[model samples]
Target: MKLRELALISSGINERRNPQGTIYYIGASDFVAPSLLNKLIKPSIMPSEKLEKHFLTKQDVIVLGKGHNGFVGHTIVDDSKPMVASSSFMVLRDFHVKVLPKYIAWYINLESTQQELRSYSRGTALPSINRTILGDLEIKIPPLKIQKQIIEIDELKKQESKLTTQLDQLKTIQLELLLKNKIKNYEQ
Candidate 1:
């Protein structure tokens, strides 16, 4: 099914900053990966009432709409505070019952899917995927049970990668300590 058929695709808000604003703004730089976002620090204040409609929820999936590197991120905002993505992102919400938001984000973040998305980008300097192109992109929907399993496996892979990095660092430190001890004994 096409993405538009599964969820409502809309451009993020294009508003100026307001000092007295209350909404948190998420920009392309905020993403650490296609599925992760950095902790919110300072919030962008937009002095517009229309921003209420753009407020992000946990179920919303944000896609980098304008750039050479296109990626998608699942929204991780605190529900206590209102938040909205910047104009550089396209928000997908109101997903169909047959699909899960995280599953959609995971599928899009795949290397193969990312390559396909890049192919649809336009412009030379700052290639971008317009709303129509993004909406028309195909999405493969699996059974809910399978979708849950995929998400769980993907999470485990991420955890494994992180743990492996830590282990490598520890091994390096251990080797360095051993070398230092050997040098000290030889000097003695």
Candidate 2:
């Protein structure tokens, strides 16, 4: 079945605000983490109406709220507490019983989906995606087991990357010690 056939989200642009207490912002710097979901700012206070309306949770997918043109998908699977996002971001609540949010988010991040999103962008000066259009975008769904397997493989890759970094550091130290010994020999 198609992706739109499975998921749900705000029908259109639902511009709202956090309850008036203290507003926290997530800047561009927060998006650099290696995890599938890398940038989430916690707001101290939010409009009770908005808070009740737009609260985020693990497995919820969020898109950039403002500024950046094409950053449209990240799964929030870390924090369990209440946090509000900027108006520029749109959250995709995964209600698809058979589809995994991690897989859906990863699919959106793929080069193919990015190209589709680029075509759907609106606004003259600043580009942004309309929630309605996003909701309607076509996605191809695979079985849930396959989705979980993809996530497992991705995790394995992350572990491999960590080990590679450690290995590289050890090699660097070894080379440094060898060079030091050669220098000492020349002096002798």
Candidate 3:
């Protein structure tokens, strides 16, 4: 289905904070969990007025605003907890059951969307996309089952990345030890 035809709506911000009443600040390094946001740095807090209508949920799709314009395109919140966002972010609401949130999020970050988003940005000094421009964006989505299959593949890729990092760290340690031993032998 075409993205415009599918749930064409904007996201809402949270009017309240977590039980601890902390406002989550999203940084460039925040670990936006795959399917679920596992963790993030609580850099600062925002007033309810500042985030009155930007709350996002498990299925809501988010896009980056401000400095990173069109770079970190989109992501779906799989976490159960309600989280608020900074002004430099926007959300797309689900208006239909036909489209899966994860798939839409993935589609928005694709090379095609990147091109569209880049073209959409309008500013002489700093590029930024308005809500209307974002809502106007288009995407293609498969059936629900296919969406699930894609999600599964994405999860696997995430796991593979983690394992690769671990393996690289171990190999680096081994190489460092071998080099240290060779130097010690040469000194003798």
Candidate 3 residue-wise lDDT, 118-174, digit = tens: 787878577877677777776666788998898778768879998999999999999
Most accurate candidate by TM-score: 1
lDDT per residue (tens digit) for residues 37-78 in model 2: 343544535445644556667777766634444655777766
Q: Name the regions of candidate 3 deviating beyond 4 angstroms.
A: 1-4, 8-21, 27-29, 32-40, 46-53, 68-82
Residue 43 accuracy (lDDT) in model 3: 29
Local distance difference test values of all predictions, in order:
0.82, 0.65, 0.63
- For model 2, what is the alpha-carbon lDDT of residue 164? 100
TM-score: model 1 vs. ground truth: 0.87
Candidate 2 off by > 4 Å: 1-4, 11-28, 34-49, 65-69, 123-126, 169-188
Best by lDDT: 1
Sliding window of 10 residues with minimal summed lDDT for model 3: 10-19
Q: What residue runs in model 1 are displaced by over 4 Å at the alpha carbon?
A: 18-21, 180-188
- On lDDT, the stronger of 1 and 2 is 1
